[model samples]
Target: MRFIFSVLFFALMTFSLSAQGFNNGVSGEKTFTFFDKAGRNQATFFSTTPLEDINGTANGIDGTVSFDVTNIAKTIKGHVKVEVNSMQTGIDLRDSHLKSPNWLDAETHPEIRFELTGMKDVKSEADNKISGTATGNFTLHGVTKEISVPVTFIYLKESEDTKKRAPGDLLGVNSKFNVKLSDYGVQNDIIGNKVAENIEVTFNVVGTVK
Candidate 1:
C-alpha cells in the first residue's frame, strides 16, 4: 500500500512539471519599421520664436523586436535606428542649419539610435495591448543617455492571410519621451535662443514576427 501511494505521488509531480514547462520561452524575432508617411517619426520642440514650433521628422527608421509572450518581462528586446540627415523642419535654410556643425552635426553623427535595456511596471490591457515603461540607452549627437520611455504595445494575432504572407504575429508599438538638448552636448547660444532646451520625441513602430 505504501509503494502504491508513493508511485501515485511521483506520477502527479511529473504531470505538474510537464504542464508548467511551456510557461516560459522566447518568441520569434520581428522586424519593425517606423511608418513615416504622415511624419510619424517626428520630434516637436517649442521655442521662443513666434513663427512656429519646429517639427523635425525622420523617414528612415528601422528596427527589430524579439518578444517572449509567456514571460513578457524577461525576453523583450528591441533596437531602432534613425537617420540624422532625414530630419527636416520645413524651412530649407533652417533645415540646413540644423544639419550643420553647430547643431545636430549630421555629417559627423549620421544616425540616432535607441536600444532597449529593460522594462518595468508592465501592465496588460484589453485587446492584446500592453503598457509599460521601457528603459533604454538613447544615443544622439555622439552622446548616449539613459532614458525611460512610456510605451504601448499591441499584439495582432496571425490570421490566415498573415500566415500565408508574413507567417508570424504582428506587433505595434508606440512610445513617447522627452529629453534635454544639453544632455547630449547640443548647446549653442544662437540656436538655443530659437530652439527650446527640451525636445519631445515620439515613435510609432510596427513589427512583424520572423
Candidate 2:
C-alpha cells in the first residue's frame, strides 16, 4: 500500500507539471482581412513625371497569423498575401501597365506573399502593446528577398465588443516598410525615369484568436 501511494503521488505531480507547462503559453490563430471597413492596406510610389507621388491600394489583402502569446518573439508566425490583380493605382491605364508582364506580372504571379522569419528588438509596453522589428521573406514578381519591417501590436482580452464580434482575444498590428522594384526583377526603361524604383508599403491589420 505504501508503494502504491508513492506511485500515485508521483503521477499526480507529473500531471500537474504538464498542466502548468501547457497553461504557460496561450496559442491562437487569426485571419486578418484588409477589405474590412476598418482596415487599410496601401503602397506609395514616387514619380518624377510631373514630380508627383502615386498611391496604390489593394482591398483584397488577406492572411493568417498564428501566435503564442507567452513567447511572442519566438513563437509568433504569420503570412500575409496580397492579391496583385486587385491592386489599383487610381488610373486605369497606369494600373494596367503596372500589372503587365513587364512590371508585376499579375497574371502569372497573382499573389505577393510575406512569411515571418523572426522578431527582434521586441519591447513590451504599457496598455498591452508590443513593438518590434520583424524579419521576413518577401516574395514578389517571382523573386524572394529578406526584409525587415517595424511593427507595433496591441493585444486585447475579450471585451464586450470582442465578445459580440471576435469572440476571443484580439490583436491589432501596424507595420510599414520600403521595397525597391528593381530588386524584384521589375524594370521598365520607359517608365523608369518617371516612376521611382522604391516603394513604401503599409499594413493595418486586426486579428482575432481562433
Candidate 3:
C-alpha cells in the first residue's frame, strides 16, 4: 500500500508541474464589413454576427490551436465554426429573407467552417506573422463545394509586466477568403437571381497551446 501511494503521488505531482494548468484563453468578437451600394460605401453590416466565444474543445476555434515557440511551422491544424443563422446585415427584412430558402437556407446548412491545409513562415518589419491557405467545405442552399481561402496568422506575445500568461510566437493567419451566392445556388432574393458575387472574407486568428 505505501509503495503504491508513493508512486501515484509522484506521478500526479509531475503531471501538475510539467502539464499546463487551466489556461485562461483569449477570445474575440469578429465583425463583418461589406462594401454597400455597389462596393462604394463600405460599412459593417451585422445584426448579431459575433462568435459564440471560443471554448476549450476539439471543435471550438480555440480548442484545436497548437503553438510552438521554436518551430511554429510544426504547429499546424485548427478548427472554427461559423453559425449561419447568426448572420445579420442590419436589416430585419433582409435578415428574414436571408433566412428563407433563397440565400443561406439556414435550416439546412447551419455552419460555415474551415480547416488548415498549409502554412508558411513570414517576417514583418515589426512583428512575426504566419500566412497560409485553408480548405473548407461550405454547404449553402443545399449545395456543398470545396473552396480555398487565403489566410494570414499573426501572433502577439504578452509583455513581461502583464499579469497573465501571454500569447508567445502568436500565430497570425492572413487570408483573402471569398465566395459567391449564386455559385452555391443561392440567390439574393426569390425573384432576383443576381447575387452580389465575389464575397470577400478575411480572418485574423490567434491560437495558444494549452
- Strongest candidate by lDDT: 2
Question: Candidate 2: TM-score?
Answer: 0.75
* Stretches > 4 Å off in candidate 2: 1-50, 163-165, 188-193
Winner by TM-score: 2
Error of 1 at 184 (Å): 0.3
Model 1 bad stretches (over 4 Å): 1-50, 160-168, 188-193
**Cα error, candidate 2, residue 160 (Å):** 3.0
Across residues 74-126, which tens digit of lDDT does each residue of candidate 1 receive? 56677888888887777788778888888889999998889987777776564
Residue 144 in candidate 1, Cα distance off native in Å: 0.7
lDDT of 3 by residue, 1-210 (tens): 999999999998754422221112333322112112222211122111232211111111222444443333334445554456665554467566766766677788776555444344322222344344445565556666776665554545455632143333233344555567677776544223233455555443344333
TM-score of each: 0.74, 0.75, 0.54
Clash totals for all models, in order?
0, 0, 13
Sorted on TM-score, highest at the top, how do the candidates line up? 2, 1, 3
Q: Order the candidate numbers by lDDT, best to worst.
A: 2, 1, 3
Cα lDDT of model 1 overall? 0.69
Whole-model alpha-carbon lDDT for candidate 3: 0.44
